[model samples]
Target: MNLHQESSGEITLLKQKAFNLSSESIRDEIVSSAFRHTLAICQDVTKVKDQSKLLHTEKLDKILTSRLFGFPIMLAMLGIVIYLTIAGANVPSSMLASFFGWLEGYLSLGFQTINAPDWLHGVLVLGLYRGTSWVISVMLPPMAIFFPMFALLENYGYLPRVAFNMDRLFKKTGAHGKQSLTMAMGFGCNAAAIMSTRIIESPRERMLAILTNNFVPCNGRWPTLILLASIFMAAGFTGAAGTLVTAGVVVGMVVFGIIVTLAVSWVLSKTALKGVPTHYTLELPPYRKPQFMNTIIRATIDKSAFVLKRAIVIAAPAGVLTWILANIMVGDTSILMHIVQFLDPFAQQLGLDGFILMAFILGLPANEIVLPILLMGYLSTGAMIEVEDLDSLKKIFIDQGWTWITALNMMLFSLLHYPCGTTLINIYKETKSKKWTFLSFAIPTGLAIAVTFAIAQLARIFGWV
Candidate 1:
């Protein structure tokens, strides 16, 4: 009955009263488990909050993701990227073209010295060489510049903020917020983006992401857009201002593309694929110093090379086939000419011509191939022409009756259409359903047709033709 014994008895009685456990240890065990769970929950929230902080962001998020500034900042980022791709790409592309052209000359000289026939020289040195050269010269530089910047933003943890900002729109569209992240990946490569859709646990949302992913411009498409913008928009201005305006237009097109994507997603979710978009808890990782060497190596070796190889594989055959189409006569004209003539009506209706439309269809294997196909179609007329630089490309298009509207339509179609063959394959692999894959293909094509049709009609109504 001393004080110490009395205190011990009271503690035991309190524990027993709380849980009715015969053992005093049971109450302690329950309290410990609850505390651990509570601590874990708090840690998770803290981690999320800490990751959202931008060390050097300058409160930019307030403006960058604001309802007013969000769209404009997005456009600025896009324009800057495109401008960098265009202006920075020029020297490297010219160097690459010179090197490749030299190599071709050597290759042709060797073929002649070895007594190779004209047909062999034409097919190998001219056809395949010209096609693959365009891919390397045009694609390599922009990708080298663009991918690293993309990786830097991604590495700096800015992209997650982009996703966070976009989540609500995705939710409204009945798509997953994580779809924004996947769309970012699509800018690298649509196939990779489609694969990244796996991050979404919901099957329905994943399919939606896969189908809509191509709305974002992929690396392969950038060269085409940048080239188009520079030719039609930038060419008028001299020096730095021209560069800025070209970049701005290219960026504007991309922003327009994204707007179209969101609109299409909203429509699809409400109709063909109607459902609620599932929400995901995205934990933004901390911004770290981007490893420059690793990014260069990975972007060059992993991204650029991988994309290049696939494109070359597809382009070589496409080159040969294109050459054959251009060379082989169908009564009075080459098969390519006849085919272009046949499709001209529909192509014109879309504010493009048959050759451009044909290029797009053939280029479906790889967006890198479209310009090459168009070149082959043009060069096959025994012109002895060579596309030595971006300016030369502009000449070809102009000679072929290209107007501002043609360039605009080409850019729009490139932005709006279904992704390439590799992307389609990735979608099929990820979704594991042909029906959804078909839907993926159908939706984008349908939209591309509809949107271009409207633009074409508007242009004609305005007498811009």
Candidate 2:
């Protein structure tokens, strides 16, 4: 044979070899052998003199990973983190809101002094500045508190334990084990979580992770959840008890989101993304003492600031557009009023009003601005309103015919609806498939509508609404 024929034969042989080795059983046997060989050469060189410390660590791990106790412990830890965020964020959020409210007065005065037009002042100060301020005040505190706590867990190596605890559930759902990590990341920022799916080696599993990342509530949604829980759900209680109850409600929402994530992952796996789950080894790392300052700094700068910056960037332009829509009068009513009236019937079926639905639609650019937009619409102010406190906010909702059902459905919709513009863009970029990107939006939105409609109808039938 000539040289060309010889090269062709070699390439064909390699392809045949690859094909033969691609079976799951064959791959498992190869992995087992490799691990066995590595263990044969490796030795525990360090002698642990203190058996007490080792015993304590092992005992803790046993409890943490126990099937009966593991999930509860994980949830308890989550509740604690959220409780801390809710308690810690209130003071700073109020201060920031006050400062911004004071600054707005100056801005309005500056505009008038400079002879700026009413439209220009309204769009810039009443719309863009107000929106950005609301986002910062509401979003920054919870993130500042939540991210550092999350980072401390990460630094202490507890996060891997969480992933280990969640691995089996993911595997059963036909997703990669590392998807739990991405889901946790999603709690901080869905865009970042979507990006983190690169860690999954399998293309199919990675895509699954990206599609489901939005099921977890991100920092942008925290403000809405916190506000609603505080105003509507925890209204009966007062003081620290009320705050704790509010935190519990938020934690319940997080758990519900996780349940939705798993359910959707299962449905996707059985249908559009059918495949057997591939196994991968996850080595639990030894827990270490977390460096407090480093954890805070990194979490604040890398996670908190990164997410907040993206929200502000998207929210500013949305604020301008929202202002224009609210202010531009077509007939007897503003364009915003007309759109809200159009959506009222369908929104009513979902236990929400027209203004609430319109707020959510307009707030698609950034979830952080949803409540402010809703307030603007309800108040007929044609600009975002900054309430002094939760009481005032609650009163506004009451005036607008909001009840427990409205709050409940609103929270559920916020939890399950289509992702923000940033998350959608990231989904498209990561999947590079319009079909998957559309599914990413469609799946959650359909679920939101179905769930809210069912609950609203049932409540009405039972006279509970």
Candidate 3:
């Protein structure tokens, strides 16, 4: 201990402490003292006069991420998106169907005039015609309506708010905030979503994103979900309520999809790719006016065309295969029915029959083609059944023993099942490993089977059918 006294004391005695120290150490101590003293002075000078006038990210975060309004606002926005898509798609689809139907008729007449061979006529006129036309008619309208609005939202910088909204739940799953961004992209296309996983730097988190990306129903599956939900779920209601209810169910499936995504992410993170979420900042840009003309042009011409081209490439072969399956017969049963029968046992165990399952598998080449193939299978009834609208389509399903349970299963399966061909290829390319690609495919498919099985078995036990 050292005793010391200073400053106007009667007897000031200073105790001297002796230590062996290098000159460099003494200089370092002096420099540290000076630096801290300067910082203290600067801090005192810069202190704010009023705390309430402070502006920072925290204030902005409170308003955007408030518990009182965040989820409700999210649902409202989702409703608006679906409502716009449904309202905008109807007239365009009808117009395109009429134009394509005329073209098919013209091609048939031209073939007749040329005395075309039966096989030639069937292959080109019927197979290609029906395939390409169905793709164009069914796939085009939704893309046209959904993409521009999505792009506008993106361009306006609302995407980061989406990330902010989903971050806490995602963090619980040990996934990165950017995973939400990739999932949002999946709503446009799963392939694109998988590609966007590049933003996530961690291998474990990136893999989780890749594996669970398909949980958000992509644009490909939207038509099937929308059509079925509109037909079976909301059929009793009429007018505005019907539209709203249909949109509501569609949005509900979207919400359900997001839930499945988070659940799957949590499971995968804990079981296979275990880790904690690494920190990353999400910048929320100020909202800006969406360029009206450019938004539409880029959405339709660029985004829609890219997806459409992929669909066409996959759908053409699928269409021909579907046609063959419908036309060719073995003894008395057609090849399609034979295939469906082969799948029946497995499908029935899950509450879905062979035809429904087979159609989905075949349509994996493109989800847009699933309904078309199912239609072909139904129309091949060796009768001229002209399906005009949603009601007629529901009748076909009803004739095939589709209860409300079937409709429910169909919607769930469409939302949770395996992704399209492009997504499969994208997975393989992104992972650069066959193992991961297989896992990506198997995981969702396994969930789909499990969920469908539970729903079906429960319903059966309760005699809900």
Candidate 4:
């Protein structure tokens, strides 16, 4: 205790160690050598270890980490997780939607009963209330299901295996291998993913991960892609087959996003952030039994609710603005239509209408609200609308002149678009620089526009639309 307290000797000792950085090369080498020697001694001295457990872990690792099977297994596991989320959320989402619809009716009746002003009713009930409820109804169930499963997988120590498998690919792109772990976290939430970049030791590689993380569609954007896949891509199928197809498309998008992340990382390494890639040894922890219920509770409180709360906060006010825009007129047409019309010309070249583009702009605060915004814009109902019925949504899109091309492009655009406001804020916090924050937003937005434009044009040229 006396030695721990401050004294003249403490000052002398601190001065002696002040310039010794623990993470420096000399320190790392010393620690690495110590660990290696210790490990060798332990392995030699240990006897009659749990051979069954060791053999089981080794066998599982052999298959999961195989050169040929690793990527395929990773994709299949992703498909399964997505399938579970989509299938499990379907019934609950509809029930929530119905409950919200029922409550809205009573709220509207209460307003009318009190002789409330029509505009006030519209703002509070139709706009604010509807928008928030839309988020809860649509966003909650899927997130509720997805995050727990994701957390469970993470707790099982599978993410390091992912990093191990993708390390070679990332190294080729001049990025830190552990970026794969951060990128996997992105599947849950990009803001969280940005924060996770602290695990990477190299500032340049960390920035590469931060900038490219948005390409991987997060929890908020998955709803949009899943909805589109259900409505259009899987329309020809039914039951389990339909579900599988939707999951398959989502898996394909995820793979594409990863490819884009690598490509962008390579580009940045060669040009802006040019530097030799740093290397690190990744320790793959042994798998452990994840307590399912505890994981679910933690995931729900820590991830799902946090994201949903942020979405509701933004969606409510944005809903009012959308309602106002849709209601207030410029001459004969509503201001919303006027704006959509203005954007339509440019947006069409991207294979998306003005309303869709405008929705993307308005929904920048939260990706979960993008579909609801687009729905309300399409109907021009002066309020947000929540629809979980794929058939009805398909009909609405068809009425709006949507084709397979529109659906395909919408999925791509959603997958590739700008990071949400929350993610940008987190990026700024992580980077502590306005310059890199702007690049984080700009890089993905530009790529989304460029890629969608190229694909849309190619489809047109081939008469595929």
Which window of 10 residues has the lowest lDDT sum in candidate 4? 1-10
Q: lDDT at 331 for candidate 3?
A: 97
Clashes of each: 0, 0, 0, 0
Ranking by lDDT: 2, 4, 3, 1
Q: What's the CA error at residue 79 for candidate 1, in Å?
A: 2.9
lDDT of 2 at 56: 74
In model 4, pairs of residues that clash are none
> What TM-score quantifies how close candidate 4 is to the native fold?
0.90
lDDT of 2 by residue, 1-465 (tens): 654565566556555666667565554555565565444445334566777877777788898878988899999999999999989998999998999999999999999899999999999998899888888888888888889999999988788889988988998798878999999999988878889999999888888888788889998898888888989999889999998999899999999999999989898889888897778777667677899998898878876667567756899889999999999999889999999999999999999999999999999988999999998998899999877767878898999889988998999999999999999999899888899899999989999999999999999999986
What is the per-residue lDDT of model 4 for residues 220-299, given as tens digits with 9 covering 90 to 100?
A: 88888988988889988999999999999889899999999999999999999998877657777888899989999998
> Which candidate has the top score in TM-score?
2
Ranking according to TM-score, highest score first? 2, 4, 3, 1
Model 1, C-alpha of 226: deviation from truth (Å)? 1.2
TM-score of each model, in listed order: 0.84, 0.91, 0.85, 0.90
Residue 245 accuracy (lDDT) in model 1:
84
Q: Where does candidate 1 clash, by residue pair?
A: none
The pairs that clash in candidate 2 are none
Name model 4 segments beyond 4 Å from true. 1-38, 45-48
After the best TM-score superposition of candidate 1, give how far the Cα of residue 1 lies from its true spot, in angstroms. Answer: 34
